[model samples]
Target: MNSSVITPIGKILNARDLGKLVRDLREKQGATQADLANFAQTGQRFIVDLEGGKATVRFDKVLQVLNILGVELTATRRK
Candidate 1:
Protein backbone atom coordinates (compact mmCIF):
# COMPACT_ATOMS: atom_id res chain seq x y z
CA MET A 1 0.00 0.00 0.00
CA ASN A 2 1.23 3.48 -0.80
CA SER A 3 2.21 5.29 2.36
CA SER A 4 0.21 8.32 1.34
CA VAL A 5 -2.99 6.36 0.91
CA ILE A 6 -5.07 6.55 4.03
CA THR A 7 -7.54 3.73 4.35
CA PRO A 8 -11.06 5.05 4.14
CA ILE A 9 -13.41 4.31 6.97
CA GLY A 10 -16.91 5.25 8.14
CA LYS A 11 -18.51 7.50 5.56
CA ILE A 12 -17.46 7.58 1.93
CA LEU A 13 -18.36 11.06 0.79
CA ASN A 14 -18.97 10.17 -2.84
CA ALA A 15 -18.10 8.03 -5.82
CA ARG A 16 -14.75 9.66 -6.39
CA ASP A 17 -13.61 8.94 -2.84
CA LEU A 18 -14.66 5.36 -3.23
CA GLY A 19 -12.85 5.09 -6.55
CA LYS A 20 -9.64 6.53 -5.21
CA LEU A 21 -9.70 4.18 -2.26
CA VAL A 22 -10.29 1.20 -4.50
CA ARG A 23 -7.50 2.23 -6.81
CA ASP A 24 -5.17 2.65 -3.85
CA LEU A 25 -6.06 -0.72 -2.42
CA ARG A 26 -5.64 -2.43 -5.77
CA GLU A 27 -2.26 -0.84 -6.25
CA LYS A 28 -1.30 -1.80 -2.72
CA GLN A 29 -1.95 -5.41 -3.61
CA GLY A 30 0.12 -5.00 -6.78
CA ALA A 31 -2.82 -5.97 -8.91
CA THR A 32 -3.73 -4.56 -12.27
CA GLN A 33 -7.24 -3.55 -13.16
CA ALA A 34 -7.56 -6.67 -15.27
CA ASP A 35 -6.28 -8.85 -12.45
CA LEU A 36 -8.75 -7.37 -10.00
CA ALA A 37 -11.53 -7.74 -12.54
CA ASN A 38 -10.69 -11.41 -12.91
CA PHE A 39 -10.68 -11.90 -9.16
CA ALA A 40 -13.97 -10.08 -8.81
CA GLN A 41 -15.43 -11.98 -11.74
CA THR A 42 -16.26 -8.72 -13.42
CA GLY A 43 -15.24 -7.14 -16.71
CA GLN A 44 -12.08 -5.08 -17.04
CA ARG A 45 -14.20 -2.25 -18.37
CA PHE A 46 -16.20 -2.41 -15.19
CA ILE A 47 -13.02 -2.09 -13.14
CA VAL A 48 -11.93 0.75 -15.38
CA ASP A 49 -15.19 2.58 -14.97
CA LEU A 50 -15.12 1.89 -11.25
CA GLU A 51 -11.58 3.14 -10.56
CA GLY A 52 -12.28 6.06 -12.85
CA GLY A 53 -15.26 6.96 -10.68
CA LYS A 54 -18.01 6.36 -13.17
CA ALA A 55 -20.96 6.82 -10.79
CA THR A 56 -23.50 4.79 -12.71
CA VAL A 57 -21.85 1.39 -12.45
CA ARG A 58 -23.97 -1.37 -10.93
CA PHE A 59 -23.95 -1.58 -7.13
CA ASP A 60 -23.44 -5.33 -7.05
CA LYS A 61 -20.28 -5.05 -9.09
CA VAL A 62 -18.95 -2.46 -6.69
CA LEU A 63 -19.61 -4.83 -3.82
CA GLN A 64 -17.80 -7.57 -5.69
CA VAL A 65 -14.63 -5.53 -6.02
CA LEU A 66 -14.79 -4.37 -2.42
CA ASN A 67 -15.23 -7.93 -1.30
CA ILE A 68 -12.34 -9.21 -3.38
CA LEU A 69 -10.12 -6.46 -2.02
CA GLY A 70 -11.00 -7.38 1.57
CA VAL A 71 -12.73 -4.09 2.19
CA GLU A 72 -15.78 -4.43 4.32
CA LEU A 73 -18.61 -1.94 4.19
CA THR A 74 -21.41 -1.79 6.66
CA ALA A 75 -24.69 0.00 6.47
CA THR A 76 -25.61 2.07 9.46
CA ARG A 77 -28.34 4.46 10.45
CA ARG A 78 -27.36 7.94 9.32
CA LYS A 79 -27.61 10.33 12.18
Candidate 2:
Protein backbone atom coordinates (compact mmCIF):
# COMPACT_ATOMS: atom_id res chain seq x y z
CA MET A 1 0.00 0.00 0.00
CA ASN A 2 1.11 3.57 -0.67
CA SER A 3 -0.52 4.76 2.52
CA SER A 4 1.32 7.12 4.83
CA VAL A 5 0.71 7.87 8.46
CA ILE A 6 -1.75 10.71 8.87
CA THR A 7 -0.78 13.57 11.14
CA PRO A 8 -2.96 15.75 13.28
CA ILE A 9 -4.52 18.70 11.45
CA GLY A 10 -5.45 20.38 14.74
CA LYS A 11 -8.81 22.17 14.75
CA ILE A 12 -10.28 22.35 11.25
CA LEU A 13 -12.53 25.38 11.14
CA ASN A 14 -13.42 25.17 7.47
CA ALA A 15 -13.24 23.29 4.19
CA ARG A 16 -9.91 24.82 3.30
CA ASP A 17 -8.34 23.40 6.42
CA LEU A 18 -9.43 19.90 5.51
CA GLY A 19 -8.27 20.38 1.94
CA LYS A 20 -4.86 21.58 3.03
CA LEU A 21 -4.44 18.65 5.33
CA VAL A 22 -5.30 16.23 2.56
CA ARG A 23 -2.95 17.95 0.15
CA ASP A 24 -0.17 17.92 2.72
CA LEU A 25 -0.64 14.26 3.46
CA ARG A 26 -0.73 13.37 -0.22
CA GLU A 27 2.41 15.32 -0.94
CA LYS A 28 4.16 13.82 2.04
CA GLN A 29 3.48 10.41 0.59
CA GLY A 30 4.89 11.56 -2.76
CA ALA A 31 1.74 10.51 -4.49
CA THR A 32 0.37 12.29 -7.52
CA GLN A 33 -3.20 13.53 -7.61
CA ALA A 34 -4.03 10.95 -10.25
CA ASP A 35 -2.48 8.21 -8.19
CA LEU A 36 -4.55 9.14 -5.19
CA ALA A 37 -7.69 9.39 -7.25
CA ASN A 38 -7.09 5.98 -8.75
CA PHE A 39 -6.37 4.44 -5.37
CA ALA A 40 -9.48 6.00 -3.99
CA GLN A 41 -11.50 4.85 -7.01
CA THR A 42 -12.42 8.41 -7.86
CA GLY A 43 -11.82 10.81 -10.71
CA GLN A 44 -8.95 13.23 -11.10
CA ARG A 45 -11.37 16.13 -11.28
CA PHE A 46 -12.74 15.16 -7.90
CA ILE A 47 -9.23 15.17 -6.44
CA VAL A 48 -8.50 18.56 -7.91
CA ASP A 49 -11.79 20.00 -6.76
CA LEU A 50 -11.24 18.47 -3.34
CA GLU A 51 -7.78 19.94 -2.91
CA GLY A 52 -9.16 23.25 -4.05
CA GLY A 53 -11.65 23.08 -1.16
CA LYS A 54 -14.83 22.71 -3.14
CA ALA A 55 -17.49 23.09 -0.49
CA THR A 56 -20.11 20.93 -2.15
CA VAL A 57 -18.01 17.81 -2.57
CA ARG A 58 -19.65 14.48 -1.88
CA PHE A 59 -18.96 13.23 1.63
CA ASP A 60 -18.53 9.60 0.57
CA LYS A 61 -15.88 10.51 -1.97
CA VAL A 62 -14.09 12.58 0.60
CA LEU A 63 -14.07 9.62 2.94
CA GLN A 64 -12.71 7.44 0.15
CA VAL A 65 -9.83 9.81 -0.43
CA LEU A 66 -9.11 10.02 3.27
CA ASN A 67 -9.09 6.23 3.51
CA ILE A 68 -6.63 5.92 0.65
CA LEU A 69 -4.40 8.41 2.44
CA GLY A 70 -4.75 6.55 5.71
CA VAL A 71 -6.56 9.42 7.35
CA GLU A 72 -9.00 8.62 10.10
CA LEU A 73 -11.76 11.07 10.98
CA THR A 74 -12.89 11.51 14.55
CA ALA A 75 -15.28 13.73 16.41
CA THR A 76 -15.73 14.66 20.04
CA ARG A 77 -17.69 17.06 22.19
CA ARG A 78 -16.09 20.43 21.99
CA LYS A 79 -14.57 21.40 25.32
Q: Which prediction has the highest TM-score against the true structure? A: 2
TM, every model: 0.82, 0.86
TM-score of 2: 0.86
What is the C-alpha lDDT profile of model 2 across 1-79, one tens digit per residue? 5356455667777788888888999999999999999999999999998999889889999999998997788876888
User: Quick one: how many clashes does candidate 2 have?
Assistant: 0
Compose the digit string of candidate 1's lDDT tens values, residues 1-79: 6875555564677888889889999999999999999999999999999898889999999999999998878766779
Model 2 residue runs over 4 Å out of place are: 1-7
Best by lDDT: 1
RMSD of candidates 1 onward, in order: 5.7, 4.7
- Residue 8 local lDDT, model 1: 50
Q: Name the runs in model 1 displaced over 4 angstroms.
A: 1-10, 77-79
